[model samples]
Structure formats: structure tokens, C-alpha cells
Target: MTSASVPLSGPRFQTEPAELYRELRRDHGAVVPVSLDGDIPAWLVLGYRELHQVTGDPVLFSRDPDLWNQWPGIPDDWPMLPVIGRKQSSILYTVGERHRVRAAMISDALEAVDPFELRGHAEKFADELIDAVSGKGEADLIGDYAALLPVRVLATLYGFTDEQGPGLVTALNDMLNRTADALAGKQHLAASMGQLLADRKVTPGNDVVSRMLATALALEAEGSGSGFTDEEIVQDLVVMFAAGHQPTADWMGNSLRLMLTDDRFAASLFGGRNSVAEAMNEVLWEATPSQNLVGRWASRDTQLGGRRIRTGDLLILGLQGANSDPQVRTDGSALTGGNSAHFSFGHGAHRCPFPAQEIAEIIARTGIEVVLDRLPDIDLAVPAESLPWRPSPWLRSLTELPVHFAPTPPLEATSA
Candidate 1:
């Protein structure tokens, strides 16, 4: 596998991934053997139907990390352990009937979020974020606004205090930043979640975490819930925390980048509210937040996308690759004008639960709308092509989206 594999790391993965994906498709066809950080081998599923088939049949391509064949070679301290999920007991690793119950609990908890209230929270946080920078004519949208908005909103939804938002952000940044302190940051986040779960147990509120606890209890009362430990609940909360923040933040950042850079959305950035949604949808197709998902293990030897995948083989879902699959998207036309056949949110039973998708949409769209509304005349500070992207194979996100807008007073001074 190492002989034919390409290491899935480089500037190409960041700055010009679509071109890289195209190249991989030409050379490796749909199922490309790729190497992770430690030269560990995995198959990247690049075909649209193949990715669909893999995700759809969870039984065949199981989420259980224990099934991975490379476990013996994986170092205990491997950096990829978190991503590949070594011995994960969370919902992401759950399989079969238990996965269904857990997914339902998560969906119900998120679904109970009041749409109007959710929008209100999004607006509140978005306005606050813009206010922090509105007084300056220049701002890095990624760091100052987009990176900060989703987590703040999510923290509120999950019952974290305004005071705790900064801590959560710090923890998440440290964890994903992949620095020497990454493990410490991850441990801190897990501790915080465990504490929150303990607090919710004592006095549950109308928030997502509390709601999850209540739902679990209700399901157990009805004999519909799988018995899971508080530790597992904490892990699931951490999953929700990580999943909800960065991707949605990138969704906002990427959408804003599109609007600022593309002529089709330039006018829309001013006051055209409708094009905000259009640009966001377009980003999901072209620059999806999640580029690849650390993925399923083959339940048995099987052929996929012309490659023979052996039992216990790891398969990464090449989301952007599948979305841009030439077989399905032959026209070469942009999917911007609301063609959502893209695999951005994934597919099948384990796909992002529909309710979670709605929350992300609300946070992302609302965040983008607030930015455009606040900085009505904003423009990119640097050449669009010169902007650098974060170097991570899993996510397609900008390092910084620098922009200049007319300096204005903070929103609070002008609002009630």
C-alpha cells in the first residue's frame, strides 16, 4: 500500500484542492490509496456513487474503529489517533441499533431548539462579533468574526455561560491547532463537558445539553434508549461541540469569501439577502467545510470504485472529491444557483442528522447576513488569489479573510 500511496498532506490540499482531487481521480481512479500522517495506509473513496454506497451501507463499511487493520502499527501517541478515533465510545463510533437510538436522541435534542430563538441567538452573537471589529476599518474575518461566531452561538445553545465561551474556544483552537499542547487541550475540553453533564444532571435547563439528558431519560423510561454512561454522554457532547463549531464557522467564512471574490455575489454582499443563501450553497459544492471525513472500516473484503478493499481496511470519505465527480457533474457548470445534489453533508443513516443540519444553516446564514448588514461596503483587503488556506486535509477553510470596511461605532452604542 505504501508503494502506491500518496501522502494526504501538502499546500495543494489547502490552496487548490479541486485541482488536486482532479489529479488524483486521473491517476488513481475513484478509490485512491492515501497515506495519513504516519504513512499509515487508507483508501480514499473519491467516486460519488462509491462514497454514497460506502456511507449508505454502514454494516459493510462500519464506523467501529476497533475494526481497523492497522491498529498494531498505530503508535499509542499517534497524532492521528484523535482523528481516526482510537477506541472511541462516542456516537461517531457507535454501530447498528445503538447508533440509531443515539442519533435519534441527538436529533430530538437539537430539534427542540426554538427556530426563532436560535435565530435570535445567532443575531446576538453575530452583532457582537461585528461590533468588536466595526470600529476598525480593517479586520481578519476568519479569526475576528467567522471563527468566533459559531462556537459562541453553540456554547449558548449547549448551556455554556458567556464567560465559558472564550474558554471553550481556546480549548477547541488548541486541540485542533495540533500543537504540542493538543492533548492537554483535548483533555480540558473533555473535563469541561463532563462537568457540564454533571451540572445538567442536578438542574437541567432548556438548552441542548439539558435536553439531551432529558431525552435520554425519557427514552429509557419508554424502553427505547440504549443504556449509555455519563462518560459516553460527555464524549458525545464533545463531538457535538467540535462538529458544530469549526465547520459552521468555515461555512460562514467560505460563503463570505465567495461573495467578496465572485462577481456573481459581489452585489449581493451589499444588501441582496437572497444571494447569501446562494453563495453558501455554492461554497458547500465548491469549498465544503469538511473536505474528508475520517471514516469507515470495511466489514469484509469488497470491491468499491474498481478497487478491492479488504476487510478491516480504513476508507476515508472524499467529500469534495465526490461532490466534484466528473461522472455526475459533467456540465462543468457551477452548482451555485441552488443545485444541492452535492455530498457536502454526507449521505445515508450516519449523515449529519437533519436537525443538526438545520442548526448549522441557521448559524452560518445568520452570521453571514450580520456581516453583510454591518459592513455594507466591505471589500477584500488583499487579492483574492493571495489569501492562504489552513493546511488541513479534513477541512477547507481560509487562514484569514482580511477585509476593509468603513470604520463605524460599535452596535451597542447605536442600539438599545
Candidate 2:
């Protein structure tokens, strides 16, 4: 009921912030008031159901990135803004009709895509990845498998070769991991992608890049205002790569760990390849990769959960807290089989613009299926307690998961 804003503590705001989230959930569920850095006062929405409503409501929340400057905790000179075109243009930062148009284009393209078409390709990738790590009996899941796999698939989607995937991964990780130096990496990624777009404009191909180029050209030819320029195209590229990789990688690791650690769930998931679907839902619910509170700024003075927030106040949604809420899954009946309605994919218009949500679900389900079917009783090389966890606020991922497997004949492709 306090109308006043409280200052956020320094230790509370982190690159991969999680500790503060735990505290907020334990202390306040409706709307916990906190400060960021030292002076920025903001309200953290802790419940999952409320978080869903916050993300979905555009009238109450504005997507404008400039509002951060008004907030004390975040630096006004944050480099990622201009470099990623968060200021000039980016569908994620835009609101209303503009967001709608850009989203329409992406949704149309995704609709044209047949997720099943990638089945054989995904299975093959799964096989190759698992096989490469098979003999070693101990592989760093994050460094070796999870981190590398999605980027490779993304590169293929962009019509790039397997060899180019690692470079792209490195560039993206360096940018996101180092928030202070994000601008430099953004420029590097942008320049390279601009060249790729220019080449595609000259001679188109069947890939996401070529498709985006064609879309830009057609929009411009129609005098529909300036479409995505080379830099804007690059921004999307940056988002796709950075957004897609770590989250899914984390999901794979977390999901695998859950099945292994929980006997009942393991029985369901490891029993058959198709059985992983249920376990996937449980893992996603329990350890959502997107653990950070999503950012929003108030468009006007409004009361949330009885607390009055003035116009321009920054707000963050406690995603992790919401997922674990008993109210969201009250009966315990849903997750009785370990199922949950976690907002890992986000909600409403600003949800994942790419087909990443669907793609990740498929990859996680299929990837785990492949491993379980092929190597049924393979124990983790390193014990779960010994596995290292990444200290990231936004992602729940293991640094490495080493596992040892006894030799076994490959299962028939039919089972996969």
C-alpha cells in the first residue's frame, strides 16, 4: 500500500539476476517495490498470472526504450540501445500498429514454414551431436552440445555453412555477455550482416536472410515507407541468434537434469522418445530459461495490486516467481504428471517474434528423445551436485554436464 518508490540495491541488479527475484517472491507476491542500481525505483510483478497480464496489456505498459533514461538505476548512455537500433527502430521496441505490421510479416513467414519439414534435419543433428560425444563418455553439455547446436541450425537457416556457425555464436555471446562492450560487437555483427544483405539483394536464395531482403525490397518498391535497412536487418539477426541460442541450450541442460534427478519423471521421459513431450513441459515449467523480470514502463499513473505507480515508472515482471506460484498451478493436479503453464515464451504482442518458442519445444523434445532412446541407462559422468551452474539472471543453464555412457548399438531410426 506504499505509494512511495524504494531504491534498488546494487547487489540486487545483476547481469543474470536471480537472488533478488527469490527474495521478492518470498517477501512480496502482488507487486514488490524495489530500487535498481542505487536510485531507480521500480515495481517488480512477482506472480506468474500477473506477469502474464502485465506483458499482454499494452494500454497500461508502453514498450518505448527511452523510458530507461528517466529511471535512475540504468545508465542513460547504455550502448546496446543505439547499436541494436532499440532507439531508431526494432519491432520489439515499437508499440501499436507498427508492431502489428512487423509481427504480421514474421508470422506469415513462420506460418509458411512446416515445422515437420525440419524433423529429419533435427534428428540428424541430434544423432551427429550425441554420436560425437558418445565415445568420450564425458562431454560439456553447454560448451560442446547445447551452445553449438542451435547456432548451427540457425546458420543453415540463413544459408551459411556449418563452419560459419561458431563465429556467429562467438560474436553473439561476446555481445550479450559483456553488456558494457555490447556496442562494439553490435557494430561488428551489423557490418557483416549488411554485406550479407547486400549480396542477397543482388542474388536471392531460399533462406531467412534472402526472404527478409525480398520483403524489404518489395516494401520499398511499393513506397510503403522505408523498410528495414541493412542495419535494421542486422539487428534482427543479432536478436535471432542471441535470443535463440542460450535459452534453448539452457532448456536442454535443465530438462535433462530434471529427468535424471527425479525418478518418476525420468521413468516417463526415458521410457520412450515420444514420452519426452510430457517431461519437456515439466522442465520448462520448473526451470524456465527466461528468469529475468521483463521490463515495462508505465504510460500513465495507474494502480497495480493496490499500489499506485506514477507515469513513467519502470516495471519488471518476476517470471521465475510466477512459474513457481502455486496459484498458477493450484491443484498440483496439472504438474501431478509434472505439467505446468509457465510463461517461458512470454505473453501477448511482445512475445517471442521468431518461431523460437515452437522451434525450441521441438528441439528439446526431439533432442531428449533421441538421447533417451539411444542410450537408456547412461548415467551422468559427473554427479548432479558436482555440475556447475551458470550465474546468469536471465537463463538457468549448467556450465557443463559431463556424462558417461556404456557402448550400445544405435537404435533404429523408426524409434526416433
TM-score versus the correct structure, for each prediction? 0.96, 0.84
Clashing pairs in 1: none
Score candidate 2 by lDDT: 0.65
lDDT of each: 0.88, 0.65
lDDT of 1 by residue, 1-416 (tens): 12289888888888779999999999889899999988899999989999999999999999998999999998888978767868678899899999998998889889999989999999998898888889889899998988788888888999989899888887887787777877887898999888888999999899989988887777677774466678888899988888888889999999999999989887787777889988889899999999999899999999998788999999999999999999988996676777888888889888998988999999999998888889858999999999988878988999899999999888879875
Per-residue lDDT over 200-238 for candidate 2, one digit per residue giving the tens place of the 0 to 100 score: 888888777887777777777888775666766676766
Each prediction's number of clashing residue pairs: 0, 10
Query: Model 1, which residues run further than 4 Å from truth?
Result: 1-3, 222-225
Candidate 1: minimum summed lDDT over ten consecutive residues — where?
219-228
Instruction: Look at candidate 2 and tell me the lDDT of residue 380.
Output: 74
RMSD of each: 1.9, 4.3
lDDT of 1: 0.88
| Local error of candidate 1 at residue 128 (angstroms) | 1.0
